[model samples]
Target: MNFDLPLADISTDIWDTKYRYRDGDVIRDASLEDTWQRVARALAAVEAGQEGVWAARFHEVLANFRFLPGGRIQAGAGTRHRTTLFNCFVMGTIEDSLDGIFSALKEGALTMQAGGGVGYDFSTLRPRGARADASDTIASGPVSFMHIWDSMCATLISTGARRGAMMATLRCDHPDILEFVEAKRDPAVLRHFNLSVLVSDAFMVALDQDADWPLSFPPGRTVGNVRARALWERIMRANYDSAEPGVIFIDRVNRLNNLGYEETISATNPCGEIPLPPYGACDLGSINLTRFVRAPFTPDATLDLDGIAATASVAVRMLDNVYELAHFPVPRQREVARRSRRLGLGITGLGDALAMLGLRYGSDASLDAACAAMAAICHAAYRASAELARERGPFPAYRAESYLAGEFVRGLPEDIRTAIAAHGIRNSHLTAIAPAGTISLLANNISSGLEPIYAYRYQRNVRRPDGGLTEYAVEDYAWRLYRSLHGDAPLPPGFVSATEIPPDQHLQMQAALQAHVDNSISKTINVPADMAFSGFETIYRNAYALGLKGCTTYRPGAGRGQVMTADQQPPAKPCCELPGAD
Candidate 1:
């Protein structure tokens, strides 16, 4: 069967370079149809006598860019490569001892070598200048050891393997927290790690009251103290000068976790979407919202809610099947994965989808539309998982009482909750909005994840299989589609790029979706370089107030490099050093 081919050059480039199946010199995926069929057949093989029936369903969802699996699944499924199907993993904690640190480092290396990104909570390490009780030796803090891991990641990437993405998280109260926050000030240091402050509720309250906050470690050992507001100001100033350490509401993450009863989430998979316990991995896929928009750019524009629901259901099954077929890098990862089958089923092309509906993103009307669409997808996904549980079985970690008591679950529709109580649920957690940057490009450069369009047109640099960079002229999906329809007509007011949206509205959009998302959403609140430092700090404060799980922002001239430049901006040579980027 002939499926619609990729409409843009970048779409074809991403597929061929990132997702296409190849056996050395031989290309197995001759076309995108072959790629989709290959993945569908592989995943459906685990369906127990319903392979043909389910394969067709999977293919239909995957075709036409309607649903996109994580890059690992698309590239490794049904192939001979011994790589994981999951995109990322939160590695087991880094033990403070020498042996412990190296063991965790080895695990990260293996995981990355097998084509999966990794996240690590470095708060376990002792503070710099702290004397070890047993060894009577001075200890280097988490930030110091991070350099070792950074070197390891750089070495792996230099070896011509897949690009490495990692997230390193430090508790806001850790004695070395200040150093961790400042470690990335130099562009050349820790290039492979995306750092985040694991901000607890206590710290926020302390900041509110202008209290002196103790920097404690090793359980109740106060190594130092600083004014809470002062520390926060330092964080904000660091980010304002150089967009390094993003903020994560760590306490809220655990509180809202569907598996909170069984696990403590201190770190997230790279890109801050899947907050995972040690050894936990995320099986991710995204339903393309653009494909579900009906009569786009017309007075009758509306999201095809039924279509999204159907596609989301099938996407869950496909992600669940990934567990059966995946080649986990470590046995512990596989063990944790089987116990709690986590699926990050989210949406891509949201910006374009909103624009297609003639609703400006971050507007009140757009928030309602986004909420309604996410609600449909979220509930539909839950219902699908429950049905799978009855057909197969609940995930090993599922405890009906504890699961039902979760904040996110208790808020679900009664019928869906009832379904879960009666028949269990296959996946422990079901929704996470990822930075689908690369996959969105594969889908004709639709606005990525929940972000507004970065620009109507830009030059995107894509890395070739041989490690060289190739630049492509890319245009927004909605922009191109609208041009096709109206022949260079003036864009409506609904079309707004990322820079044009206010930081608060960006937070609002994320907060609106976070209501339905169990796993966190990966959104970068783009702010202008000239924004006041005080105003910059308020964005993080607002994120906490608005109950967002985390927040990241990018300024044009920030320390971090860019992958693309708008037509009006100065040209930028593409850089792949971004860790949180998809």
Candidate 2:
């Protein structure tokens, strides 16, 4: 399988040599030309299918940045500016209190209508019996407030196009923990929200030792007297059945968080990967990890490391420019953006990567290859960032060797050193790993963010704008493998599920690669609801044990949140008048 690879015309040759890439080295291409065409084809499919809303948002979504400092801004008509996502933390609350529960409803209605995602750590609102200091009136707690917010989302269509993405996070110790645990089961509860329960490292350890875990909230409340193992049991039970609530390792998110000391992060953006401060919309983009291929995969399966580093140089350039290409909204985004022009350069098609090299997705051989590939990419990305610092000058925070050291004076690339001494580089932090939601959906139907195939092929029925609907069958790599092997064959039973894969396997896969990432990894564990909640304690331990920044898990009925399922419909939006009229 080995063949000669030309050093010249490398960008083009690398991908062309993919056929020859050995089992140890392979990357999905990051070239704009091919990716652009693929994006166009997707848009065309949506348009041809008369998916106006989806099509309309295409340009916007591509330009949208969901990392921090610069978030969202309006797109000028005459010219296109790189766009960023600006999320409002507490959109409809605080401003209106005791009596005006409906005050913030309109904000939610309108924002979600514009296709903007919203999230808030409802735990701040006083619990069921607590009083609002401002109005002297009793409060109904976070869950009641969620009902109003959910109703708004139900009423408004995102940008009158796609559905809005929202998140509601609650502290595990909240007195209403029991109620939040099973809120989603009603099928009549929050219909437009995704829920996650925040857990701490202290609590996780209790579960393992069979110690009493508190079900108490109110910072000073008595820690409930139940065995930690028992509480974990309830959590695992819910995950097995409904996949309602997800668990968030709050303490983990804060540890080593570059910005952890600056602010407390309670919620994550739409896809439980990128954690953000309330009202913080982060600007984000990715470098196609496939660009590092240096040579052909000979029958022997060797990889080229030098070429990977050089192309990583090009990727750093593209991501750095993304800051300038994008238009940021609000002063905070612009300010923070100035401090660290951050970007997430994550990978995709990992399974495809392993498959191309003839490696199994779950085996030890593939795991080793995956980890090595990640290290190479990480080293290259950092080196490239340093190179840019030399020429244009380092990021404001770019230190010599210390992460927080800001002055960029010594030990820079020769070419960049002069440029840095001349015209400082435009961005700060240059890397992150995002889940790659739409991008993954459009390209090859690969499992994203290190996720295995949930189902070989599952039908996703989307409610269209006209009140009608369309169904999409997402096919996984395994199913495609079966189809290609026997185009018309259908004789097997007991097929493998991503779930069929072992638990530790998932952790090992995420951990092996996470070490090399600057920000964090956005992978989720799919535990069956029937499985015990107690199982989660181990999953949490393994992540920290593995040295990951953070981890999230899906369990049924984990919190009090709203979501759109077949059975429940969105609530009608409220109609109110001008300032004083009503």
Maximum-lDDT candidate:
1
lDDT of 2 by residue, 1-582 (tens): 222122223222222331111223433334433333333233334233544443334333232121111112111111222223332222432332544455445644544554446666766556677666776888777788888777666666533433556777788777666566666766456656667778778887886678877755556676456767666666555545555566777887766455543556777665555665644444444433323322212234333445444444544554454444434433444545545555555565465445445455567886887777666656666666666666566656443334442222232335644443444544443445566544444333444556665556554333444434444444654345445555676524323445666677777888777666655566766555465545665776677677765566654344323221222233222221000000
RMSD of each: 1.7, 11.8
lDDT of each: 0.90, 0.51
> Per-residue lDDT for 153-251 in model 1, tens only?
889988988888899999998988889989989987988889899999999999999999998997588878999998998888788888989999999
TM-scores for all predictions: 0.98, 0.68
User: Stretches of candidate 1 above 4 Å error?
Assistant: 1-6, 579-582
Cand. 1 TM to true fold? 0.98
